[model samples]
Target: MDALVGFTGPPSETLLRSMIATLMHRGKAPGEVFLQSNHASLARLQLSDDHAVGLRLDRRGLIDGDVTLLVCGFLTRDGTESPGGSVALSGLIAEYRARGVAALARLQGAAIVAIADETAGALHVARIGAGVRTVFYGRYTDPSAATSRWLVASEPKAITSAPAFQAAIRPAAIAQYLAFSFVPGSGTMLQDVFELPAGHAVTLSADGSSNLTNLFPFEDGEWDGRGDGDDHSHWVAESRRVIADAVARRLPVGEPVGIFLSGGLDSSIVAAEVARQHNHRVLTYAIHFGKHYPNELQFARSVADRLGTEHHEVMVNPRQFAPRLRQMIWHLDDPIGDPITQPNFELARRVSQDVRYVFNGEGGDPLFGGPKNLPMMMQHWYGVPREPGFREKAYLASYRRAYEEWSRVLHPRIRDQIDPERDLESILAPFFQQTSVRSFLNKLMAINIRLKGAHLILPKVERMLAASGLTPLAPLFDEELIRLSFQMPPRMKLRSGDEKWVLKRAYEDDLPREVIERPKSGMRVPVHFWFRGEMRRLAKKTLASRHVREAELFDPDRIRQLLRYDIEEGAGRYGMRLWMLMTFELWRRVVVDRDRTGVSGGR
Candidate 1:
């Protein structure tokens, strides 16, 4: 969770310090700032002393005469000493020095790199690989100066710290967030602020002009050739080898590592691989919502027992963490309406005490087909009058978040500004329309990996774990595994009615039969019961508050109707909608309203 913040403008120590202050939670160590006549860059180092071997190389940046390089996450290469630190920085610098920005495409692992070239009068920022790491940039114009300044950081809050940067809410993004539970593309909830997508780069010039480029486009069908043969065993063997290698690359040296085991196929696969390779102890953590709600602990325990891992099961409920809601939202930076956000944060808090690194099975569903793809596939083949945008609409509805209720939930003023076609469907249009990816399933996988995996799943996990001072290692999300998924045929991903078929076949012997055979009932957070029980009062008070009404973003009457479960259809499903509303309001207080007092004691 170390961060980098910089701007293209006349050097001002105060401006740089202010931005760093907002991100102090990311790292308590004093920030190191590099300044020149027209640019300033700051790095907030957060790694503990035990992991500081590479601090000297790029903790601030690898500075050459006219060019300086800064990286916020680890980078890896074949036979590199480690995934990150001095060796990685040395390798990265060499590549950049030789190939310039093109070197970023050759880079692997999860990282965001920034190269500032004083001679070229340009600053380039790129997110490497599968977008496990995030970088946000926004343009801020100083009233006193003629030229606009571009502000960039690891999180959006840093950009908002500048006084001149306006943080107006983008209604269309909110609509998208409701549909996907997270904003889909580069656009965030803020108007001017944008997230750099995976395999994309942006360059900022002195004159305030910027150009965005897609560095590695997944839609290009480059990986299709890998799965060209009809021999299924070859793919299964190749998948097993590639996945093992991915996990091996991520295993920490001389230290215990933890896995967020849900007893699901993804986490189990990761755990089995880690246990197979690591010399150190393997710890697995699972969560349940007390005995009142259905739990996955049985399956998780079975896997843990099979692997002989030191398993720990924790129970999280609304009553225990409600007071920290605002603090959690603050950590999220962007609102993610998924109910599991709190549980992820809580689990990280526990895991942080035992290990600095944690691994999870995050990419399996998105990379290979998962259950969510089934409904869309069914609609694609069987039910539907063929119509334009049918795929987009069906995909949006599959999330089952707030998409159907977005318009009803938003105030008319907010709704008036949003056009679903321009804002919502447009994001998915390019992927669906791209003929380069021949299979419809692969196209869905493209959207899932690029949009959901990059934006929602990876960012949410990274932020929550980073809050607890832990780094997440997603072996499944490795760049190699991502390409492998695309290379393998669509049927290899989802065969007959089974999802992630190849993944299951790859680890069939390594994992328990029950774990592999069971349908993926994901870590289901009991939001419905919480709204009727523990979180009921809190939801009622927050949504009905004057501040929410004054903000003119949500319809108060609709919120009340949702709270009361007054709607005839989808009655019990209002918990997610309410959670999204509450998360946005709390986020508004911290980021938009700048209400520091409201952030503490989240009641």
Candidate 2:
């Protein structure tokens, strides 16, 4: 968590010291600076004194005036023995210049780097592929030109201040965030601030006067393994190999590594792999809401027993759920609409008390079609979507929703885009512009990867652990694993009614047939029922308050109606939409409002 800020203005020893001190808590080293203004200004904090490469580079920053880069790397609990030279900062410095953009092409670990040119004042900023590391930039307003200097940091809360930062929340992004509960791609919750897209970088000139130059581009459907005879079976084998490799790379140090085992196929498979490689059994953790939740204790226990891993199960009640909500929101740094965010936050906190690292299954769905929507997608693709009245049925469910709800949950624009009278096939045509089923599936995968896949997993789990100063790993998100998943044939990934078939096939030898055959039991938090039951009073008060009504972001009347009305017969998927909206309002109140007071600036 090291931060370096260099100003082109005349050097001020005292001011520089104060700026370095800003990063003191975030870093392990005492804050210090070396100024040769005409040369380059450098402030360095080596979060880990053991990792001395940062100290060496901090020295170079003072002498070299061509390019200035600030890098911060976080080692999860499991990363203690990451092979001596794997994370060397000097190698990264050399890679940037020698290998150019390719230097980070195969890089691992959670890290963010900002490279600045002292002479030319050019900056190249990026994060690791899965965005386990975060880098955000805001334009510092300057009057000399129509532009401002680009300020970048590791987190949004860090740079959302400085008088120069604009707090305009991107509207389109807000809609997507509501739908996905996480912002996708390079966009951030704030309008001016942007997360450097994963596996990508941007180059900006020193004077802060230049259009963004994308150093990495999103390339999909580019898997060429097919020509090499790596068909579906080959891909299944490769998937297993990559999963093992990724897990081995992130196993815990000192203590046993922890796993967020849900007893579902995803985490079960991950736990099995960890058990196979290491002597110590992986410690699997789960937060349960008694029997009302996923009822995963029995299953998770069974897997742990079979693999001889020690399992810790904590049953959670409402008392444990309340206090952690704020902490979770703080780490997520974004409006996370899901109720499970609370549980995941608590799970990380509990794990952080003892374990430094935990591995979970996050990206399994998007890459391998493990989500329920896949069946819908498959049904639509084969012509059932063309049947009359399907769209009508979906839409009527929304209208039939209880009047207690105020606004309809569906995005108004998405709803308008779909003709109310049209069939499901016609409704989906716009989202999937491609006619080919495989191509459309890929596009769907891309959306999930951008939003639901990484969005749900990283922000909730990774960010939660980060808030607690712990490290969490998602093996399903490994770049090679994702590429391999794409290489698998559709049938292997999703057959008849079974999703994640390829994932199961990949680990057939390791897991019991019944474990692999079990239904996908998502971590449950009865938020839908809670909206109509125990939390109804709170929902009414929150939705009717001046904060929500006066803010006018969402229609108050509509919200009230939705909250009051019970959609017991099942309001189609209306609950998901309504829940998303409610979470956004809560986020605005908690995060966006406090952001206005100026405490959440510059990490």
Candidate 3:
């Protein structure tokens, strides 16, 4: 629930103080520091327990005699830290000693660790895993030294606002944003502000030299995820235990809590486990879109009634979209094209009034596989013109819009500027390479974990929940459960055309068989269908508005054509595409045009 920011320069007390003020725009700012020699500055936010934030660990720490570390996220330590006890960066160095940075592997939670060595005047930064918590670094300069300085922060605004890095939009990042509906890879919209991808680390020297490191490289080794034997029951039993423990640890100590029960297998399973472990009727919340959309209220309520839990439900409509769109994007710095984001936002807002922690089945699909995965795998294997990157493009193209369609979607000017295949490979290739000596299913899962989860899903949840003043705990995304998930053979993940086969089996008796066996159509938000009818005027006005034209980020004629087709012959078919365009326009208005009021309301 907290963010961290730091700079290494002839410390401008002004900049340090400004960063603290700007950081407050995201969360509470209770921490700030600057070395007397004007070498470093730091700021941190400690969120209250009411937000239901997980791993309530402090960020500013001194590593014994070696380094000072500013940690943005939490670390699932080997043992307790004196019951909410926090260790200084120096204390960690003293505790772990020579092991020092190597002990970071013991970290099971999300974190962006920015460590500065006092003895050596050197710095090291790393991200713990593939979670929403991220660090963006960019080089700025101190006029006095004529040397390069750097700014790092959990949010890009902290770094991008500085004179050194904030200039204009990065075209390549815009191209990727236009392509994937969000900025992917290391690049952000700001040309100089680069995100540090998960499982990677960077080292900086006082002399202005730096190098990047990959914490977990497949080349170093491979984990087959083999258990004691080929026994299916043994694997299922282990899956249950690991997932159960992950869920249990995430719940609040003695405060009210709830699970986002969509009655889908993942949330249902999480709810059932909470009931089993806590021996109480856990509070559950589910989003109920009105009729004409796919509603899982019956399934969700059935699970709730069967578990004997306090149940709460909230409804959403297309009318709420206009006001919340910018606020949602503001919450999510990088706009996720998914329409369900707003619904989750409202769900978090409403549920926060009743519970501090809200657990959801967010990572289940990426780990255990999901329905949409099978077709992508098929396309990857069966795609024609199978060049070096075609399979990767076909499999990982989240937009699912054909490359041939790009010319018509984006203008020839914008479309020609981007090399779709090249962009796809740039983002997908690195993770795909890690699949060496692994199953194809595992390969896809790993790619999704590194790409989709890290970029789209996890960040969306993290920001929206924070904006709603609630913490999101995805047990399925728990560090150990994710690692354990990889160990299971692909067959267990997607077996005989059944997605999450092993997970379904693990929860068969505990959850209703109908719920477990039902074909998974994950939380369908009827936005596409509504856009064709109820939301059409709003969609058209937003997509074809003058503000969008002023931005000139897209082609007007192409947008008109798409809108015409979607409104006429296409109907709800291109619903996802329409939503993406609308989302980008809204984001452009807010982030580029400085439309703060567009993002006014939030927790």
Model 1 C-alpha lDDT per residue in residues 478-529, reported as the tens digit of each score: 8777777877778888899899998888899999899999999888888888
Q: Rank candidates by TM-score, best first.
A: 1, 3, 2
**Which of 1 and 3 is ahead in TM-score?**
1
Scored by TM-score, the top model is: 1
CA lDDT for candidate 1 = 0.80
The Cα local distance difference test for each model comes to 0.80, 0.57, 0.68
lDDT of 3 by residue, 362-464 (tens): 8888888887788776765675655677656665454553233544666555566777656645677766666364666777777667777777787778777
Across residues 1-603, which tens digit of lDDT does each residue of candidate 2 receive?
A: 344444333334543444454344443344443533442334555432323221112232322335455555532212233322244455556667777655555554455555655555556665655665555665655333334456555556555534434466565555445433566556677767776666567666655554443332333433433564425677677788888877766665445678888888888888998888766647888678776645668788888888888789887765655444444555566766666777777777687665656788777887787665554565466745655555334322322322222225433543344333332223224335543334545556655665454445565665566555555667777666766666556666767767887788888778767778778767767666666555556566656746655675665555655665644445644555555665566666655665332223223
State residue 205's C-alpha deviation in candidate 1, in Å: 2.0
- Model 3 worst lDDT window (10 residues): 28-37
Segments in model 2 whose C-alpha atoms lie over 4 Å from true places: 1-65, 74-95, 98-103, 142-147, 163-166, 207-233, 292-294, 384-438, 454-456, 566-579, 595-603
